[model samples]
Target: MYQYDNYDQAMVDARVAEFRDQVARRLEGKLTEEQFRPLRLMNGLYLQLHAYMLRVAVPYGTLSGKQMRMLGHIARKYDRGYGHFTTRQNIQYNWIKLSDAPDILADLASVEMHAIQTSGNCIRNISSDQYAGVAADEVADPRPWAELLRQWSSFHPEFSYLPRKFKIAVIASAQDRAAMRLHDIGLELVKKDGVIGARVFVGGGMGRTPIVAPEINAFITEDEIISYVEACLRVYNRYGRRDNKYKARIKILVHELGVEEYRRQVAEEFAHMKALGLNPPREELARIAAHFATPAYESGLSDDLDRSDPDFALWVDRNVTAHKQPGYAIANISLKPIGGIPGDASADQIELMADLAERYSLDELRVTHAQNIVLPYVKKADLYALWKELEANGLGEPNLDLVTDIIACPGLDYCSLANARSIPVAQKIASRFASNGRDAEIGELKLKISGCINACGHHHAGHIGILGVDRKGTENYQLLLGGSGAEDCSLGTITGPGFDENGIVDAVEKATDLYLRERTEGERFLDTYRRLGMAPFKEAIYG
Candidate 1:
């Protein structure tokens, strides 16, 4: 929704020109693969197992129909006919050619988009609640702050190369839809005594070592948030480990220093930064905030949906959320359709979604970290028609947060770093639990699979986490239980030894069976797991 000004346009155009020259040099053999690795990575290009992968940033997960159309174009023209929407709300093209990298970026730049900082050590894309402005429970829209941070952090010389990659997420609702606590830095917009402020959470991450960030500052005035975040990053950049990549994330530093010491260090740095005038200017924030102004709504529109159609009713119940605006609802377009790939959208599907957004959703849509799309301002009266269009286009799946709605990474199918295949595992699991009645009976289970310990699938945050590993040159899978990626964030624990692929699927089914047998009335899988702990589930899986 935010349009790029002349300055933003010029900066992106210049970057495109620079990258084009770099790509040309690489193709001409003036730069070797080793020499081009960092350069390409800085632009969000990666050499995967089969081909080059390009990750494009979707800032704060907000995009206009125009931008979405461009993404569809890129998918069709440059890479494969489809693209993978990632857990970070970005999109990755798994079959990219090195020579087309610059051209793809240029096309992105035309729509005020880029791949910058999507994969580098510098601050990655700033994420926020996909339902930021429209959520009924929102205290404030977090996008203005997220946008401010994005502008401040892009190409910041001081943070160009940190010990490891950094991520930031902001949320305004009590429900943590953005997985706030799992980010390197998480900001919760809070209002106390009628004054808006930020509740800062620091050093949270997921990889080999998963950590739920501890609150560093319970309240910092909104005006001083930029200063506080800079202080925290400075502390991590100064003392975060450089010797070992495994120990380089800020979470490791927080664990080693203890939360109290880390808070103390951040406080000291905050004071120093404040004295040095690092706080962003109020005028600049105002300028960014202006772009996020609420859209005009028609008066006297009916809030009721014509859900006489049973199919429409089911979708409305499963995929729609209450909007703050009268007669409006936030509709989720589920990417996970039964046994289909979790987040893969064909170019035509993307274009269709863009057209629907333009026609019905105020020309704007938000990408969820759950790998879904949100038409945040759809009129209730138009729900059935929208559903019909989406259904015809294969974008309408009523499975929101269901068993078949699994989150999986590229794994060995694409990622060279992966030790095992995750896609097939996810597909198998989804297919196993494909029964609609079974999904409803099970209720609200999150199954996440990662090819390796890198945890890109966010396995550590799922209610049922599966990590694929290689044991004696054979693919094996490990199970983790009781994890969640919400406001009450918690890391999952591994259950004993790893199982083979079929064994893992059977083990998951067994766990589900145990949950169904043991659960009390209205207890979801996560609730049951938390109430009973991992003992019963562990015994059920292993026994």
Candidate 2:
């Protein structure tokens, strides 16, 4: 995990102090809600339906054991003993008091974490693949570059106010776990002619108008990434729609300008920035890279370790993945319980995970985009014992990449923008599929639920996407077919009419059952859908 340097530490400490003063002023009636809204948002505080929600950024989803423990402490001390991990690889405390937010920021800063730019119109947290450093197929780790961008964008004077919020994701692997195509700016690390480079995708995003990202440039040299990104931002900041908030995202800009014109404008801006010497400092990048070198590895594993346990095999198969190092595995902790809330971990669960991360795995933890926790490096020989501990703590759910692994948003229950309750919808759908006893039978189906058009649940990328809409004050869900969150990502197509809350789960089951019958041998839901197209599933589901 990357620790904060003097500059990082100093900036956060100052922000905390400043926010503390701002909170005092607001409470004393010196600042109005309108006056204080932007300030609070910049500090990651949101005034939600019933209370204030504070979002804490877990950069590229990586956390130290100590940092994880501190989050648990904060959950116990300031919140309702739980936190919700979001799609952007961040955590949200939904019941924070306005008065206690500054103290929360201060505590987080002490642990080398801060909520800065977790919200508002500035460049948000720079995200990368959760398996960045350890994935065997990676061309290079993308976290150092993410951190470098984080430093450069933090409180950037020019881009602080944009037409709307912006997001950026970086990936260094052939597999796109971070959903790079769904971001405003997506960068893929590549190598060309013996030189390291990046493939840049600008004006790619998801929301009401979902567009699969288009390639702006196939290969951008490593030295030009910063300037190129700045160019993209400048073009958007200048030409994006400002009349309507819904049309302000970079995706809309891409839609209106057409890909070619957008690319040309960004290129023009990049040349100008280069002429002005506005590129990110290479020395600063080198400094950030030093903080994320590979962790210390032990030479040998115990020869007398148990390997025949069925529980161990299940855990190894479902919760663990291949690691870059031999004899080690990357353990993924599923946040989805059969019918439980997605991404909500109690304080005790958090403590137990922190303990496990420190004791068995490397002293590192990560929150994943799929709303799960990851222990990046666990020894294979220790799988059984670790599984036992995790089961005891209610954190051992071996359902990764399965139907129960649902991605859901905190819908009408918390979000004012939501049209319906997403969590309950997710819970019911998960329960229905579990009842059918076909969770494993279905295999590797991503079911995403979003409450509204914002697409926070990434409904556009699910193998089966459910979108909640307000139909005459009644909760109705619109089904979409053939969405995929993979290397060849595509937006789902609408199936038919919306279903009521209770009817929605059954509808999803119908779709899945259709897949079980129509799929070719050993084919995933996505492959089956592609092979047969949306018509087969749509006819089965709708009819």
Candidate 3:
């Protein structure tokens, strides 16, 4: 909900004009495809397998209803009638035409949104907890810091081109909803002696090599956060690998340097940055923080849900979360509806969601990294009516973190870099686990699938991870177990062998069956896996 200032508006408008000219030149043959590649990528345009794809940034996953409505308009007018919400909380249009790229961007700029840094080696969109301002456990809202970083990093000359792309995530709650440890840089807001500060985690990422970020600083005062972050980035920018593209992320650099050495280097750089006065002034941070003030919540609304309807009760239990405000709840809108595509929303559905948000959720909505939307401030008394509207519009499915709620990527179906198809595999697995009673019995399970080792689906963080691969020109999948993307972060270990598509689905079912048999009371699949280790599950999956 940060409103663009006059300066912000002017900058976006200027960028749109610049891109329009660039697109015209490309179309007129003044610029070849090779010449325009980086230019296009800098603006979040990519040439995929079938068509051009455009990724638009959703800063810290927060948006106004008007912004959501514009997204719906773009989906309907520019590309296909739907858009894909990604694991990074951005949205993508998969069937874009080069000719309409500028127009699409212009429309986005009209609403103060853009595709800048959504791709490219620059700092990508900063992410944070979807329940940022309203989470009961939060020490402070992380979005203000995330937004500050966004402004500081945008078009930064020093970091315009790093060895590889960089990502940052901020989390204020004890629960790591933003996958804090899996980011290049993670900041956890902590309080001591009534003063809020940051705990910095460095060099965590997921790709071919997945590593959880190690804590670099136990506490840095909020006033010095930008200095510390700049120090970390400067260190990585200077010494991170340029020899090999595959080994270019900060995680690789940290791995090679050892955490102790990396911490030492960062400390040295932080001292220099501080001496040079690179940190933003406290007043500037206070100014940015003012934009994210909590909404005027109504008093005396009911905290109790009218759960007389079993379906409503089920949906409430599965989809609603406790809110910091009294008589209000955070409602998660499930994009994964039974066997549908995991993170896609049609124009109509998008518009309907926007309208619903405007009417009920204080005109604000949040995109979750798990590919769902959050109505962050819904009154409990209005729950049933909102549920009815959402269900009617095909936007209501009560599987929040259940087995069938799978996270998957745009695999071989759209991504040229993909070696195998992920959507069908996700579809089949969700179908296999579609029984409501069975899913409820199974409890919370995180299943993620990726088309390749790029880990776009965050397979490394799932309780059950499936990575699609091409073996002798045939699609095969590798299964992994015991990974999580929470505060207790760990990478999954692979099972014995890869499986064909059907074999993988059957294998997942078998693995779940084994879990059900072995699990003690109150243990989720992840807990059970940690308790029993991979031996029994490996036997069940491979044997």
TM-score of 1: 0.99
At residue 185, give the lDDT of candidate 2.
Answer: 92
RMSD of 3: 0.8
Global Cα lDDT for candidate 1: 0.92
Per-prediction TM-score, please? 0.99, 0.98, 0.99
Error of 3 at 47 (Å): 0.2
Candidate 1 vs 2: which has more lDDT: 1
Candidate 1 residue pairs that clash: none
Q: Which candidate gets the maximum lDDT versus the true structure? A: 3
> Candidate 2 overall Cα lDDT vs. reference?
0.88
Candidates in order: C-alpha RMSD to true structure: 1.0, 1.4, 0.8
Write model 1 residue lDDT over 113-164, tens digit each, in one string. Answer: 9999998789999999999988889899899999999998998999999999
lDDT of each: 0.92, 0.88, 0.93
- lDDT string for model 3 (60-173, tens) is 999999999999999999888999999999999999999999999999999999999999898999999999999999999999999999999999999999999999999998
